[model samples]
Target: RKFWALARTGQGTTLRGNDQVNGYLLLATSCDGTLATTATPTTVRVVCNNTLTIALDGTTRAIKVPHNTRFDPQAVKKQLGIAVSQWDTFMHRMRTLSERKVQWHEAMGFFMSVVCDVPPNSKLPEVLPNERALRKVQSLYEGGGRGATLESAQGTAWGLLNAVTEYVDHERRARSTEYRMDSAWFGQGAFIKQRALQAALQLAA
Candidate 1:
């Protein structure tokens, strides 16, 4: 089962680039134990239909209950109540990131840090960044991505972060559309986006 609750304001927030987006509280679960029951706060970009889960605090994005455990609607709703109250705080952070400008070199480094894969204990001299992915994301950030030219995104950490999300959500290669959606929301793409968010936040800081 899946559910969505729109923000109480009923109006989209204007991000730094003049982009407008609506925030939502998402609740998803599966009876067959295929998926964990989770309550997550997410935002949907109106321009490109891209989504990014909001990190309520510095790190926590969602509250989850393993399928093995009995599903408790009241408990989940209680957690979501707290998360919903923090929407303003999360938007504040996003606005701060948008106001933080990023140079081309800094953006490149941020993207590399996000897309490059190096084993924690590997002894390799240097692991090459995913050149294909790098180029695509770079192009997106440099006005090729959706909403890239918006005031909030142009030359800002928020824009760079959105670029990564756009790639993962719309441009990344997948076996099929369903597969892409699945990955974007619940698989490797999700991890990439979370990493991108953290990297961008660090840059903004």
Candidate 2:
């Protein structure tokens, strides 16, 4: 049996996600309303899922492809000629984070602040997961492998940013590989990375 893979690029659509996840950005042209794909690149998760298939080439923007287009295998291979390296992306981001410095206490405090900010009047269901998120961050801070390192650049903004990414990409529990991929790109994990990125960038100022 032979399987065919297709590549499409264009404006992507986003679906709302639960508290644990953020949302899905549908990216494929010929999706059967339930097929999807996601790549674990820095700053974004390329994805396909939940009732649609569309493709987009973007870091922070989605450009949609038409649904009726078709291409042969050679075309697919040529377009996506080589695989993107996650480590390369990480090192690039590390350069930025390394520029910004933070103390160990500040790093821990940052995660502490990431726990959901509850309104004065909140729904019961929302609180637990948010609390769990806080605990998860705390766990990572206390002893999440290299996440606990406090040395040179490792203990500052660079370390904290890595802590969040490592937790999202390697630590956080997921239902399956697909689920983890989706969450890493479109769910809470992505949001956390973005937040950390923003925080890290702020330090550079």
Tell me, by lDDT, which candidate is best.
1
Query: What lDDT tens digits, residue by residue, belong to model 2 across residues 1-205?
Result: 1112323332232212210111233333324623233222222222212111111221343322233445355644443322222233433444555656666656655665444543223444433545666666666655564424444234566556555666676666888866765665566776666666665655544
lDDT values, one for every candidate: 0.80, 0.45
The TM-score of candidate 2 is 0.51
Candidate 1 wrongly placed segments (more than 4 Å): 1-11, 56-58, 68-70, 118-127
lDDT accuracy of residue 140 in candidate 2? 60
lDDT of 1: 0.80
Query: How accurate locally is residue 38 in candidate 1, as Cα lDDT from 0 to 100?
Result: 75
What tens digits encode model 1's per-residue C-alpha lDDT throughout 66-183?
9788878898778877877777887888888889998877887787778765433344336476779988998999999989999999999988998999999999999997788778
